[model samples]
Target: MTVVTSDILMDKELLHKKELANSQAALLNVLDDQKKDSEKILKKKAVDEAILASIGDGLVVVDKEGKITYVNQSFEKMLGWSSKEVLGKRIVAVVPREDEKGEEVPFNERILNKVLRGEVVVTDLTNPFYYIRKDKTRFPSSSIVTSIVLDGEIIGVVETFRDITKEKEIDKAKTEFVSLASHQLRTPLSTINWYTEMLLTGDVGKLNAEQEKYLNEVYRGNQRMVGLVNALLSVSRMDLGTFIFEPEPTDIPLLVRSVLDEQMPHIIQKGITVFPTFGTNIPLIQVDPKLLRMVVQNLLSNAIKYTPEKGKIDLSLTLTDEKKCLLFTISDTGYGIPKNQQHKIFQKLFRADNVREKDTEGTGLGLYIAKAIIDNSGGKIWFESPVSNYIEGEENVGTTFYVELPCKLLEKSK
Candidate 1:
């Protein structure tokens, strides 16, 4: 019964052969699929590399330790360094950055380093810095940095920069033109102002009420024009690095009081309640009195001009808890700056939509000039608007501007 049979053996052999053939076909299919996938991945990688290399702006990639990992063709051309030479080198050291005054930026303060340390950095084109090339020459560069995050961890950073020499030259030319034009217009403005004043005061001849009123209007308009020209001159000087600082030991509290006294007439006109708080033990700060006064006048003017009748304004002068710095604050219950437009508040000639709609007299240069003065004085200027209160229809739909300056005398920039 268990005897071997030819037909049975033949059938078993055929079945084994069939299975072996099927196994080989399946293995070939798997190899084919892997080959296609590898080809696709290689093609995609090449495309990505080509795209990065073809970018017009200089681009570089650095690892977590800040070593150069990759650089595109534009980087090589703009920086005068080859990709082979820069790979594995420190990016900040390879390309040193300089401030407007030509001082080297500190290592820790580099934007790439800040990004590596997990800080969110934002830079604008207006704040251009210089980047050194391999030949030791530098060019004005505007750059943007972004951290390379993978799986919730920052593994690297990417920086792209462009040369802005033409832009810088254009800006300088524009400022020079403004300076020349403003100087030329001053004589005519002065003549107009003097004659109008004479007419109003009856130095030439007695005028009727209507004539006097018309002359007064002309005088006010001319005065506004003169103020604008002065503001423009100030901006041009600041931009051209010709603004001089004359620091003195100034009684800050007394200065603040004088500003308030000058503004009291306008305050009374508006029926605005003023709460002036002069903190005790505040020390006199050594600063440029004229520049500081201009800053105060701009802030207080905006507060009084923007606040509605019967609104509240708070003016405070105090020393920080450390007593090392002086803090000047002016807050008004006026129209708050729109949230979306707050970032551009200090930009030149940039008026917020809300303010422009409510008040048309703003030259949009006050905050710009104020910021420049404070920055040159080695102080900080910033503002905060209670937008929520404005949105909720509270009485304090307003903004608070703060200026903090060190108590000691700061060396004037050359």
Candidate 2:
């Protein structure tokens, strides 16, 4: 009986040991599968990163020693240096310092200190930072440097730059073209303007009624051409960043009156009646009076030109609390601009189809210039036109242009 009990205990112990061994084998298999999955995920991430680094724009990565650790194909091609030559080398060896005289200066402690202190240096206007090539030849580059940090600790910096010699040449060519074109146009325009004024003033000779009419038409056409040329010059100056603004304290009412006075002859000749309502207590605004005068003149001229004979033009100035701005509106009983074509009215070289059909002589730059002047002066412009208006026995539709300028002086008023 004692031998039989000992045999049963031995069997139970063996069985328990076998079950424990089977459980350990299962756990090992799971761990092995997990490790394989983690390695696959890691490999996928690395491939994605590699693809990103291979883009067209230059990309560089540096280590804590400010040595190039990773460089893409574009970066290598841009600087004409191989990754093998640049790896583990100090960045200063690649991008050298430039002195005030644009000479290559020796790289020293100052540059490294500033970079390590976390200064992100950027330069776009100037060109040709130094770039050392594999052949030991230095070339010009346009570059930007930004520091790389990890966990509040300075690690390294990455620089991406390009060669801009071609871009500079293109810009220089554009400037020369603008200069030459403006000069060519202005010379003949000035002569035509002077000679036309001489004829109009009878400085050359007197004339009969018909001759006077023909001469007057010639004078008007020349004047219009001069205006177009002036607009072109103004746009060119704006493009070149050389537009000058000379501002002063000016009475708004007086400026409007002066513009009306200049347009008096046109108003009378067209048989258009002017109804101007001035504000009694309007404040003087600080502005470029010449620009403001041009704005008013353009609006009034358009009104008279578009309106038929014996039509009416209404000019008004009002100050409202809602709009603490100097508001001027010029309403005319003229041919109304079509709703579809109104949006294009302020575009350069864009004339309304109706206007073009009636009058082909305009340069279509008047509203564009007026809009630009008002915008530069910190103002807004808009227009309102009725679909139809009741006339003597029918509808006489027209449009109204509204201009609103800031009451206070802009910081760049002068």
Candidate 3:
């Protein structure tokens, strides 16, 4: 009995030793796996840091409350602000934004704040704004702000921007060159215009019918050239921030009526039926009469020119419900702007493919100029194509342009 008990105890000891060895081996394997995971995490963090440091555009990240969290190296270098100085500060208070007129953007209107409030804000190059730097100097910048979402919730916002100082310089140079060339060309163009006018009026001896007809054609062509030169001059002035605005209490309805009268011949020639709906008690607003006249003329003429024979045009001028601004709307049964190319319609020297194919006479600067004028005058201009219902049929879809202007003159800055 004693010998049997001793053999069982010896076997139990051997089994206990084997179980301890297996446990130790499993522990070592788990430690090895943890070490590999730590190494991988560190390497990935380094790579991400390197990429953030190497980006050429300035980038900033802020929490949902608009507190600065991370600013890339480019942000520090471009804004002359060190990350240490700006970390944890309110983004809007650290950096100021200004419109083209040098008016400070209101705090509540800041894009960061809007993003925090759950509004999606996207800006393009067309709306370039100035960002003030640490030293109180400023540069024009183009930026995009996007919300950083996690688990279907917005946790923060990220903004990426780049300095467009060089772009502004290049654009100014181009405008200056255009202004000089236009000024130089005006002298010869004026001389040709005066002579052509005198010949057509028989101040010089009149020849046969053929000669008179040829001279009339020359006069009309010269007039068109003069018109183009004037448009270019106006654009150059606006771009260089030298355009002068002389605002006076102008009758909006009368202005529209005069423009319509001037364009009546062409409208009648095209057989386009006109419907003018001038709202009652439309107040006289403070605006530049000549500039306003030009705006109306461009819109009316474009509506008439693009519409086909027997097509319809509806023009309405009314005060908003608040009665603080005027709304001018013009819609036409014409070749609507193509869907894909609608975004480029207001660009300088850009014409839609449909328009270019239909009419070769346009300089493609009409809408561009009209927008520039309205924007400078504290008015807003926009358009909708294929006018609303968008029925696809034999008749081409049309476009509607809307312009809204404040009642009082706006203080503008250079």
lDDT of each: 0.88, 0.74, 0.86
Off by over 4 Å in 2: 1-179, 199-217, 387-396, 410-414
Candidate order by decreasing TM-score: 1, 3, 2
Q: How does candidate 3 fare on TM-score?
A: 0.88
Q: Which 10 consecutive positions of candidate 2 have the poorest summed lDDT? A: 387-396
Per-residue lDDT tens digits of candidate 2, residues 6-64?
A: 99999999999998998888888999999999999999988976884677666677666
Candidate 3: tens digits of C-alpha lDDT, residues 71-187:
999999989999999999988889989988899998678887788778856544665899999999999999878888899888999899999999999999999999999999899
* Collision pairs in model 1: none
Flag regions of model 1 displaced more than 4 Å: 1-10, 388-396, 410-414
Ordering by lDDT: 1, 3, 2
Most accurate candidate by lDDT: 1
Number of the top TM-score candidate: 1
The lDDT of model 1 is 0.88
lDDT score for residue 400 of model 2: 91
